[model samples]
Target: MTTFLTFTILGLVLGAVYAIAASGLVLTYNTSGIFNFAHGAQAMLGTFLYWQLTYGWGLPMWLSLIIVVGVVGPAMGAALHALIMKGLRDTADVTKIVVTVAILLGMLFLSQWIWHPEDARIMEMFFGAGAKVEFSGVVIRYHEIICLLAAAAIAVGLRVLFTRSRVGVVMRGAVDDPDLLRRCGHNPDRIAMLSWALGSTLAVLAGVLITPVGGGALEANALTLLVIDAFAAAMFGRLRSIPRTFAGAMVLGLAATYVAAYFPTDWTWAGNLRVSLPMIILFVVLIVLPQDRLRGAAIRTRERYRAPTVRKAVTSGAALVAGVFLLALLMDDTSITTFGLGMTFAIIALSLTVLTGYAGELNLAPLSFGAVATIVAFHFGITGTGLAARLTPWGVLLAVLVTAVVGGLVALPALRLRGLYLALATMAFGVFLSNMVLRDTTEHTLFGVTFSLFPNGTLIVPPLQVGPLDLRDGRTLLMTATVLFALIAIGLVALRNSGYGRRLAAMKDSPAASAMLGQNLVKLKFGVFMLSAAIAGLGGVLMASAGGSVAGDNFHIMASLSLVMLTVVGGIGYVSGALFGGLMSGVGFTIIIGTFNDLAAATPPMETIFKSLGHLAMVATALIGMGVGKNPSGMVHDLFESYRALRNARPVLIGGAAAQAVLYVLALTGVIGNWWFAVLTACLVMMLPVFGRMLAPTAVRETPLELVGVDEPYTPELRDRLDRELGLAPALGGDRHAVA
Candidate 1:
């Protein structure tokens, strides 16, 4: 009974912080329709600032709290809402999620960059260490009591503010109908800004309260991810209810405490389960929650791109192969290995193009699929007395098959859900795979073999054997990855042009419209999931074979989401986008950082200015990728359009090609090293599209005299109408509809 009481007191303290974080999340989402994936990140940033102010600057606790929560937090929220999230309510849900996730990652990078720590820092208690209360053999800190009361007070206070306050009604109206709120003479932007301020403030308060709960030392990502627990609580309130969210937080806290206190400490499974308890709760709640509450009104989906012709695709493929061959000739073994990694990542990104871009379903966990493949290959490809390794081809096939089955099972449950709900479900699956399967080699007899599937740490991957050929060589791996990438690219293109692709496109455009046309969305969705899993699995097998081993950490929960972000930045609608994403994210990022670092190291002053890209490249990519929301068609698409536009100036293309040829000759003659020549050639190649555009004839949108007299379509009458309706009217009549 005394143990129970002690655990109960501890649980309440934890629950109070959760309640505060969740309430803040709910508040912003309610008013903005943006389920901020970065909510926890904002809280994390606040935590760091609070710590920095108190410890680093030697400021009083009160001053630190006031500045961190008041000035820093609100300013951060206001900047996000005003700069990133304003006018995004009607945008595609993918864009919204991506933007928030970008911010989440950006803040993580920002916090680390600023603090720049080699180790964790301590968080001071709200009150003096000795301040506490004791009753019935149970002891609780004054800070604990304070946190509990604050949670309750906020819950009750928010309830009153929402129900009885005029400002609350306006805030509610803004998200539901910003136009309506504007009609009633309330500034919707102001309401959004105010909600963000309040929301960010609450997030900071939660961060401050929870700091001591982490038991002193702080890790930024760890602190940020702890809000995964709060996600369950927020979902309990359907993302909008204050009281229910509070209640849910308390329940989770109590349950977690009880599990830790009573579970067998000797069992590794029990300990792992304790770690995964919040994920379990989140998964269960997301699965069991009423679907309608999560699904909101239709968001304006981005327009799909026109399919590139086979001739163009073939031309591009040939160019790609030729480029890779030349690149292989020029690069060192290290470059070859890095390039192979890029190709492998590209293969995985192709899966995203198909699933999220082509199918219009947001999958937040693509890496889990790859992880599945890695595990399967490791198990099947090991040689032993009882069981010899399967043939390389057969092992790879088996790995893909296993991943497909897992993906199919996951897809079956997500048929009724879409957008954010589906994303959450996939994220849950990722978390489950990471927590329960990864690093969990033990078996429970009563529960069966699924629980015993994985190993404790690194899984040894056998060498890739094809008859007499050994593919463990670096060059061999690069060629193998290139071949596999080409095959997947060809397959993706074929699929995009198939009947399934047509149906998928229709369903993506409008599920209701597709159903009316007699399309079976269930089958379409299911088949695509399997296909995507297969491609992702193949990538994983290639990656593992190259590395010679696999570990659980390689497939973290955030894997799939990060892929989406990178691919989207490159472009998601085309196979080229996947390639761009792969190269840019993997090799391009590595190469750029390497070049800069080399230059930096060569000069003493510049060395300090350019840190190893290894530390900042991925983070920089994510930060820049936030702009992808504004470029819905993606950078690849724009590049292709520019390519087509530049085709009229064949001379420019020829000139750039001639320049590259000269550089290649120079490299061969040893006038310049192949590495430097390759770099120069790459730069020249990148400039072709831009130079083509510059040399190409300026596009004249002016109608021919014969068509100028026509009404509607591209005519003045309809153009003026569209301009007026879109609030693009000129200040003066003479300025309206003037031809550019």
Candidate 2:
């Protein structure tokens, strides 16, 4: 009884912090209509700031707490609202989710860069570590008591604010009907900003309280995920009710504590279960709880998906393969190998293209499916003699097929889910896999064969030999992946242009309208999920082969988030976008860092600058993702549209191609630096359209009245010009009433 009581009090302390954090999440989502994926990251940032102020800067604890929770937190939230979140209105759920995730990544890396992970940093507990009271043989710490009181105060405060206060009422109505709120002379945006500020303040409080309990270690990722425990609590209330959220937090905390206290650590599943408890609860809550109704016409995306013809896709793919082969000549073994690994990333990203791009389903765990495939391939394939020990056709087929089945099964529970809910469900599955399946080390026997996932923490792949061809060589693997990606790209293009593809697109546009039109939404989603899973699985095996090994950390949930972010940043709606994402993440960034390392090796004085730049890559990725709101269609689409200006300028295209080719040849021959060659070629490509427009301007096309807003932004000037053209503008000798 004493042990249970001790654990219960401890659980309540943990639950209180969770309740505080979750209340903030619920508040932001209720007012802004965006489920902030970065809520934990915000809390994490707050925790780090407190540490910096109190420990690093040697500020008073009270001063640091006030600066972080009272000022910094609210300011950060308000700034994020004005800069990023405010622009997300009317954007697709994917855009909102991705942008928040970008903030998460941005904050995570920024903290790491600032704190320098090598240093030992500890946050002292409030009132000192030993400040506690003994009650009937159970010891209660001061910090614990403070947390409990804070939670209670926050719970009551928020309840009263939302239920009794006019501001809270206006905030609640912000999402329901912003226009109506505006008609009532209330600024919905301002209300949302206030809610964000309040939410951030709560996040800071939660972060400050939870840090001491977590051994005072300020590990960024760990801290962020710790705050994520509040997600389960937030979802428990269906992202609204404070009281229910608090109840859920208590239940979650108690469940985790009880399992840890009573469950045998020696048991294989026990550790995983305890580690994954929050995610499991989150998944269960999402599944069992009734979901909100399908938002009718609520889905608004600026993205445009246009399927390429088979011929165009094939030609582009062939050119890409050729480009890869030529590019390999300029790279050394290690660089080429890194580039090859990126191809696998591209393949995985392509799967996202199918699921997110065409099918309109946001998957946060694309790499989890790949991890599943890698497991199957390692076991089912590579089992025979010396040459036969390599990957076999049957094993590859088995892996893909098995993963597809698994994907379909995964989708079964989440079929009714949409948008953010669906993304969370996928993320929960990925977390579970990361914590349990991928981390499993115990040997298991099936069909008289024994194997384990990441046995002893790593799964090494044998040299990849398919039939008679050995692709273990870096260049060979790169070329092989390129060909495979091309084939997949072409196939996806064909799928997009097919009748079934049309149905998927229609569903993406409006599931309700499609259902009304007799389209089977269930079948479409299922098929797309399976297809995507299969592709991801294939990419996994290839990635393992490319890198020669796989580990649990390689497919961590955070890595999956990055994969989705980079892919979306490249252009989620296009095949080239995946390819672009794959290269950027895999090859481009790797090469940039590699070049810097090479420079640092040759020039010692610049080592610090180069190292810092390499570290900045993470922050750069986040910044790029944050820009998705401005260009929702993606970078590839923008590039494509820009190049259309050069369509009539054959001489410009020829000149640009010649210049790039010459630079490539020079780099291959060691006459020019590979880095220089790459930069010059990119410059030439970007400048081609500019040169084309200057030298051979395209004919002006008349804009139809209906196409004004559809094709281009309808600005005041454009509108006024159109009105004048139609004799409706009073300033242009038209009737004032007609203009009005």
Candidate 3:
């Protein structure tokens, strides 16, 4: 009875903090219509700042609280609104989610860089150690009492603000009908900004309150993920209701405490289960929530995808493979290995192109599915033929099939959800996998059959071999991965250009309309998800084969988040985008930092600057992710369009190709320095379109029309000429300059 009361009190204190944090999340989402994935990151930053003020600088705790929760938090919120959130107002839900996630990553790494995670920075609980109230053999600290009171006050205050305040009503209206609010002389943007400030203040307060409850340690990832526990509470409220959110927080907090206290300590599964309680709560809540109505295709989107013809796909794919082989010739074995890893990532990213790009379903657990495949392959394929010698092709097939089945099972629960809720469901699954399965090393017995999911906390995957062709060699593996990526990419392009692909696109546009047209929305969604999972599983097998081992940390939920961000930034809708994103994210930044490190070793004077590039590279990736809002079509699309002028200018294409070939030959023959050849080749490619426009015949170039004849006769010849000039039709036999 004493232990129960003690745990109960502890639960209430934790619940109160969760209530406060979740209320802030609900507030911002309600007003701005953006579920801030970075809410936890904001809280983490506030916690660290408070610690720095009070513990590091020896400021009074009261002063630190006021600075962090009152002034700095609101200022940070307002600045985020003005800079990042404001631009996201008109973007897609995926873009908004990715941007917030990018903010989370940016802040997390920035905190680590600044605070150095190895350092011990403990914050003192409020009112010191002596301030505790003991009643009936149950000891409750003053800090716990204060937290409970603060949460109650916040709840009542927020309820009043939302129900009876003019500002709050305007804030509600901002999300429901921003144009209407604007028309009523209330600036919706200002209302959103105000809500963000208020929300941020609450988040910071929660962080400050929860720190001491969590042993007063200022750890970046721990604090951030701990705050993520509030997500279940927020979801329970359906991201709107304060009362329900509070109730849900209490339940979650009590449940976690009870499990930790009552569950058998000697049971290996109990620890992971306790850690995964919040994700379980979140998953259950999302699954039980009512299905959101299928939205109409009324929202304007900047998303564009061009389906390549079979010939074009084949040519591009062949070129890509040849290019990889050529690149291998220039790079050493180590570099080739890195490139192989990148190609595996590219294969995984191609799955995103099929799912999110064509089918328009957002998944946050692609890597989790890959992790599942890796484990399956390891257990099923290993025949005790030494650590890295065993190879089984059938095991790879089994892994893919099992992963696809698992994906289908996951999608079953998420079928009723869409947009943000669907994303949350996948995130929960990913987190659960990370905590319970990937990290678990326990041996279990079922029906008298004993097996360990991950023995020794790692899965050693053997290198693959097919028909006497050894892929253990880095160069061979690189070539094989390149070939696989090209084949998959080409096949995906063909799928995109096919009838089924059009159906997927139509379904993405409007599920209701698709259903009306007799399309099986459920089957289409299910099939695509399974296919995507299969693709991801194949990528995983390849990755494991190349690396020869796998671990839980390699496929952590955070890495999955980064993959989503980078894939979106690279262009979620295009095959080429996936390749670009996969390379940039998988190994590009690492390679950049490594290159700088090597240079630093060679040049002593620039060591500091080069060493700093590691953190800068991570931050730069986050910045790029944030920029996805501005270019929803992705960086690859922008690059393609930027160079589209070269398509019609034969002279420019010839000249550019000739120059690149010369550079390649020069570098190959050692006539010019390799670095110089690389630089010159890159410059020539980037400037090709510029040179195309500069040197092309005026008739072939795209320029603003003089608009001299708006009322001119709409003749077939005129139409043809106009179409040719607009680059929308084949050129006919005529004076090319006739249209102008």
Candidate 4:
């Protein structure tokens, strides 16, 4: 009983912080109708900023806290709202989601640039130096108590404010019907800004309070993991009630602590269960939540494509292939190898384009499928213990097929899930695959002997000496793998553009309408899922074959996330976008980093500028997508269209050279980076035009207000009601026009 009591107390302490985080998330979502994916990063930023002010700048802790939580935190939220959310208010949920993701990425890179946590020694200076506390035979800490008290105070305060205050009533009204509130004369944008500020402030408080307990080795990426539990809490509350959200957080905390304590290390399943508890909570909430509450009500417009002329398509394709070939021939062996890897990523991105771009499903676990494929290939190609090695090609074939089938089966749950829920589920699965499955070090034994699946081997193929050039045997094998996969991926793309693709598109645009029109949404979704998985599996096979070894690090959750980011940033739906994203990201590991290193050495200022610009670029890209009310592809497609038109026009007198002027400005501002990075960045920016087109609403003359239920024009009475509902004072005559 004493032990249980001690554990329970500890859990409560930790639970308090999680509760605060969840409340902030719920508050923001309720007001803005957006699940701020960057919330964790924002919290991390606050934590880091607090450290900078208090320790680095020699400010008092209290003063630092005030500045960070009171001023900077709220300012960041307001700026984010004004710059990104405001523009995205009328856009699709997916675009808003990607925008948040972009913000998260940008913040991550920015934090890394400003202070590389890997090299920082602030964790000990700020958090770990604290002393411990003891109560009733249980050891606790001062920081934990502080965290608990702060969280409790915030939760209680919020509860009272919402239930007992007039402002709360107005906020609730705005949440329920922003349009109706707008009619009453409140500026919804102002309300949203306030909510964002309040929520972000709370998030900062939670981060600062929790950091002392956990120690402050916080980075934007690392801290984001804590938000997973917060998300589970919000889901448990159905993202509605504040009290419920707190309760949910408490439950998760207690469950995690107790499970971790009781579970024996001897049992492998125990470890898996312990790590998987939050995801289990998430999955359960997602599965049990009412469909109406879960399904986002965003209408997506169908893409209108103008077919490229055959001559143009042929010329473009030939030129691209020839350039790649020429680069391969002229470049060093390392560059050639890097290019091959880029091609492999391109295959993976192509798979994403098919699922996310064409089908409009946010399948974020393609890397998991790749990991599975890698394992299967390793087992077949090298392991000599079982039937796997004896039947190498057959085993490989079976692995790809089985992975595809499993991928489709996994996606079955997503057919009923949408938006954030779907994204969370996929992310959870990816985490599970990375942490539990791939990271498990246990060896499989046959006949009392443990087998190593990644045993070294070499394949030698006699190369034909063509003219004066003799390609190495390994290069030939890699090239063969690349060409085979490329062909297969291209074939799949063609298939996607056919009747089957149209069916998937129709289902994505309107499942109900598609079902009414005799389309089998279930079958279509399943087929696409399987196809995507197979393509991913094939890419994995190529990746492993290229490296000649299979390692768990190759398919980390971060890798999966990077794949998703690249796919979105490149262009979700277009084939060209996928190809572009693959090349850019894949080449980054080699060419981009190498170029940055060179530039950093040449100019000391270039290092800081490059890092800052990279971070800012990510944020700006995401914001641009949201601001334009489209995905990355929309921007890319538009640029290409513009460029094509420019190329076709007769040469005119260069009066101002507007395009050249813009390039010169970009170069002068130092945002362009190295020549290669600049070119890649430009290509990525260009592809954004076609990115979110399929997910955006149709092009209409009127705005969202006119298209929605609002019929009357804006009036003073309407404005007053809006103000009242959004927690603002009504105009003098507006209060008199209340319906009651």
* Number of the top-ranking candidate, with lDDT as the measure: 2
Where does candidate 3 clash, by residue pair?
none
Q: In candidate 2, what residue range of length 10 has the lowest lDDT sum?
A: 729-738
> What is the TM-score of candidate 1?
0.89
RMSD of 4: 11.3
lDDT per residue as tens, model 4, 364-480: 667788777767765554434432222255555766887898788778876787667777777777776765676566555779988543333222112222334332334554465
RMSD versus native structure for model 2:
5.5
The per-residue C-alpha lDDT of model 2 at residue 361 equals: 94
lDDT of 2 by residue, 413-441 (tens): 89989988999999999998998898788
lDDT of 1: 0.78
User: How many backbone collisions does model 2 have?
Assistant: 0
- Candidate 3 contains a number of clashing pairs equal to 0
Deviation (Å) of 102 in candidate 4: 1.1
lDDT of 3 by residue, 27-103 (tens): 99999999999999999999999988998899998999899998999998998898889788667778889999999
Ranking by lDDT: 2, 3, 1, 4
Provide the lowest-lDDT 10-residue window in model 4.
456-465
Best-to-worst TM-score order? 3, 2, 1, 4
RMSD of each: 6.2, 5.5, 3.8, 11.3
What is the lDDT of every predicted structure here? Answer: 0.78, 0.87, 0.86, 0.67
For candidate 2, report its TM-score: 0.93
Clashing pairs in 2: none
